[model samples]
Target chain A: MAKRDTPMLDELLKGPYPSFVKELYKVQERKPMVQDLLGQLEDSYEERIGHWKHGGIVGVMGYGGGVIGRYSDLQEKYPAVAHFHTMRINQPAAWFYTSDALRTLADIWEKHGSGLTNMHGSTGDIVLLGCKTDDLEPCFADLTAAGFDLGGSGSCMRTPSCCLGKARCEWACYDTMKLCYEFTQEFQDELHRPAFPYKFKFKFSGCPNDCVASIARADMSLIGTWKDEIQVDQAAVADYAKGGMDIVSDVVMNCPSKCIKYNGNGIEIDDHECVHCMHCINAMPKALAPGKERGATILLGSKAPIMEGALLSSVLVPFIDLNDEDEIEDLKELIGNIWDFWDEHGRNRERVGELIQRVGMATFLDGIGLDPEPEMVSAPRDNPYIFFQDEEEEEDDE
Target chain B: MGTPSIPEIAEEMFQMVSESMGKKNLKAGDLTKAIRQKYPEVDRKTCKLALRELMDNGRCVYAYFGGSYIQLPHKEGAAND
Candidate 1:
């Protein structure tokens, strides 16, 4: 194949920031498919439209997902990249990896793919950008032999991801890595097969800080929290005072709930009013810490913009003991109930959040066998109108 | 009637796909519901296993027209474009 001119793409290389095109140029020598990829992208830029087409059946044997089929409409023009499909490989819990493991993946990709990879896709899968249909089974075989597997795709339970919890962060109240790995193992069938009306995602954050952004992205979000009062060390507070830290302006005034009072000597926090926002603790990490009683809050139905609009997760269970075995089983049963409801009632391509919105929240709660709690809503209804079931009408029907 | 075997379910699914080739697009959930309606003893897990067998044997393939659908593979000489 001859080199195609890509003036528009070439302009991107002129900037000071490191360019991916430059990296592709380096890999083009080993895998010539990169050259065709660049040429097609250049054509897309020129025409102001993408040339790639989706919707082909391609996967490893016995699997319905993990491989996304793609074809170039300009296949005749760029034959090398005519069948460049993508694969999503499941990442280890918390994305921890050894150098040897990474080398093994690189060797396998070099043998069967275009050698281009996204370190992690949006849903936390290691995305292999381009491969032929013929290479999929062999590549998957190599991956599984090395203790790796493909992540979920299509209408199934997507790869569960979490923040670095007890592994590194002190603010972590639960073992997020352990929970993520356990869920991934327990739901392997759902991960490998299409089992839902549409895609579902799970994300865990070690603390209410929500470093993983689960509240905005996941269908199910588990965020760590504590039940008791905040811990304070007066000596550390004295040291901060000696260092000339402005306790009133920086910590007290900054508390969203105004539950903190800065005495001339030390600071006091009203535990009753504290919403666990973690602002004061963040402002004075050395002087303050989370309480001993720790657990997680479960929220549900978050998603990206689609049929209705974007939505953040809503509080479902105010608090749950993640460390207790029986409590975990209860949580799993709740998850099962939620999936059953959505599978029976959801339309094609409808996310769980959209389904919840289509049916009133009360109906969804009733279907899942959960009682309505004050924490579920952000605010009470302003209007006084209420509808009650007529007991006389029900008695007559019976 | 006795519980339907995996191969039996796969055959039924293949026929469903064949009959609905161009008229309607069927999803995996749709096929599972239809199969369960026929054989009440078959569970969701077994239904999925049957679908897998159908794909592995090239009896049916998944097509993505806006969303995923189960359908028969294209015949020879047909243009994918």
Candidate 2:
């Protein structure tokens, strides 16, 4: 009897991109494992025909949430592929890729992939979109041998990434790169395991400008900040003013707490009123700078669209002394506790933010022993009655 | 192009139907409506082909709920309409 042909290959080749199937054709040149991936890919294609053709989910059992690997069949007949599997690679400390490393990665990709890349995914990883399951292990091994590694997916802890801080930026309040590296090493187990309730992302910023958008996209947003007085040099202020610095309109107006004031000769900052949003420092870099006591402000519960639209993470640890190992460990313990608590209690598809919303924030605070503060509230505006002081007694006209 | 097989399209349609249903059953016309939401690139004809394939394979059957029409997969050993 003739082999049962499913016509799967015909339909898949009709897609806008057919390169994944094309890649399988080069089975001779591909690594032996790639052949396995090809076979699995075909099997996956067969299985996906009924579901993916229309639109449905296909995920592994052990993992919580992942893009169900979808494929357009067409491989049994036509061998040429126009697309391949893609992965989102998380960059190192500051993404300072060595020239040699860059060349090697490009070469590896050129050899194996379609070479199209989405420079950065919303969460800040280099997303490479076409590879096979068999290629996964070996590709990771190759990348690792050449000083690269697979980033987190599914329920694993994603790569802890950071922005360029002291290395070249003038506004760096803390050593973001070092801290990112340290966290990467410290949370290796979390980074590799697929046992969490859902995926967790960590992003660090050098200052409040949030180049990496940690506030809007990560579960843990570490933004560089300080509690000490702003370093205001009158001479520098004068120089910046001479160089056409709009101190009043630019810096003072933008200050979150109106902490800055321009008095003809110089800019004055009321330290007690500064919320350290970094607006003044960013606007007048030379005139105003951060204090010597550099640390990080840690926020939690942000994400890119799961339970709801994107959320802006809220401050968890107002200030953490990153210089001390014990302090770092404190943060680790907090993270571990939250992860453990969430892992045991979180629904399969829910994120930490979702869980927090489901269970009252008060309960989460109690579980973690975190003191509830006004800043900890998901929406400060949600409780108008609490913050309403009724205009401070209205002068008590008797 | 070769005529797509019933089972092939059924499997893909089942998933698409499930995603479109999203914890709710929708009418046959609603499948095209929902399909367009997810794959704006594909035309209503392609979606109908998918639906036809699904129905042929017994993955979905029509019924009435809340005084409106809706389509759902025939659950294994389910009572007949």
Candidate 3:
């Protein structure tokens, strides 16, 4: 955008409050519209008295979703961007977009919106920000005509996102794209309807690497992993050793559990002691690979702060065989149970993480009808890491 | 015609919106017009409330424009997941 005559913004540029808008404008790859909006807001600082009111129900056509309500307090002053709503177009699985498709999306948005877009947010929605109320239908029409639909907003299930798993990554233990797409289709009502106490997020990672950081962000997390021992290729190991790679110092010694032994021929792993950190595999990729047995580990209650502090999702199910026919069904049933329990007991605006915190893990476990395993205990109070069965040992000692 | 209850009018309005649009979006004004034929005694305020209830219950969406519009959200003609 040709620098508009923003007298008020110029004045604020000299202010002490860090001048974030100016700083943003200084960025090399900034979108001009965003800078323009910031400039507009700065120009009419006095006219904009307060924040715009939101959270009232708003949407369009046969669906109970798509449109997000937005407005500017300075509607009278800035008529062009008065009721600037946000439209969340559902991003493709792993955001695989061709250049032509991307250009089409940009063209459509420019036609309907103020040309302000957030490529993708943490929730994985292709967010088209700064849209007018009247342009909702036309914008949606153009978008849908071009084969795009909206994702969830409001108190409903937010968009389900996943990492690039089977598409490109060899470390992927399961098909993240299939599961992500299947679940998105399967849970349409959840995606659209604002029935729950608060928004729910589902993010999937192909493996423990958690490139998407779903463990700390998603309300529910699915991580791919192998159930069996790590596979060690003896030939590759010998090749690495011959190629000036120090197996004893690098792989064996650096093992978190020290379960790896460099037998001078091949490395031996104490299967039970392996932590699945992927460190050895990453360091010596040619020599080691994930085991054949593959599935996912379900982690629950991950969230960012609203009521409580941010938390990583705790392991709910250590190993779920995603390959099994009944496993997906079981997973769905588990999700349903969790939702039911949360719906019945969750306070308004409280996320699933906050709900679990308010009611304790035992209650959550019972609510889902899952028998609490020792694996579920993220932290232990006393010693005896190995022989942890029940409270009987503590009682006996007492 | 006698006045219809909020829930009755809301349900009917919801149905009208669904049938009227099929997959397309329905303006809130359209529902008001249709609802008036059946329940002439209902005013815009009450109709709006009923509409709000429907929207909240996931029957419809607000359409998120400067003004209120109700539409039955559908999953058609969109990109594949």
Number of the top TM-score candidate: 1
lDDT of 2 by residue, A1-398 (tens): 10223255446656788554554445424444344345445555777632111112222122212222334343333233211345656577788878887788776665555444566666556666555434544555566678776565555678778888889887777888998888888876555434455678888898777888888888889988887898987898889889887778888788767777788987778998777777777776776788988888888888887557777777777788887789988988898778756754676556777787788666776677666555454531233112312334454442
Instruction: Indicate whether candidate 2 or candidate 3 has the larger TM-score.
Output: 3
Against the reference, the lDDT scores of all candidates come to 0.84, 0.61, 0.74
Score candidate 1 by DockQ.
0.44
Scored against the true structure, residue A223 in model 1 reaches a CA lDDT of 94
TM-score between candidate 3 and the true structure: 0.75
Candidate 3, chain B, TM-score (2 decimals): 0.72
Candidate 1: list runs displaced more than 4 Å. A378-398, B1-6, B39-42, B52-58, B73-81
Q: Which ten residues in a row have the lowest lDDT in candidate 1 chain A?
A: A379-388
lDDT of 1 by residue, A34-143 (tens): 88998999999999999888756677765667888887888888787888889999999889999999999999999999999999999999999999877989999999
Winner on lDDT (1 vs 2): 1
What are the DockQ scores of the candidates, in order?
Answer: 0.44, 0.02, 0.07
DockQ-better candidate, 1 vs 2 = 1
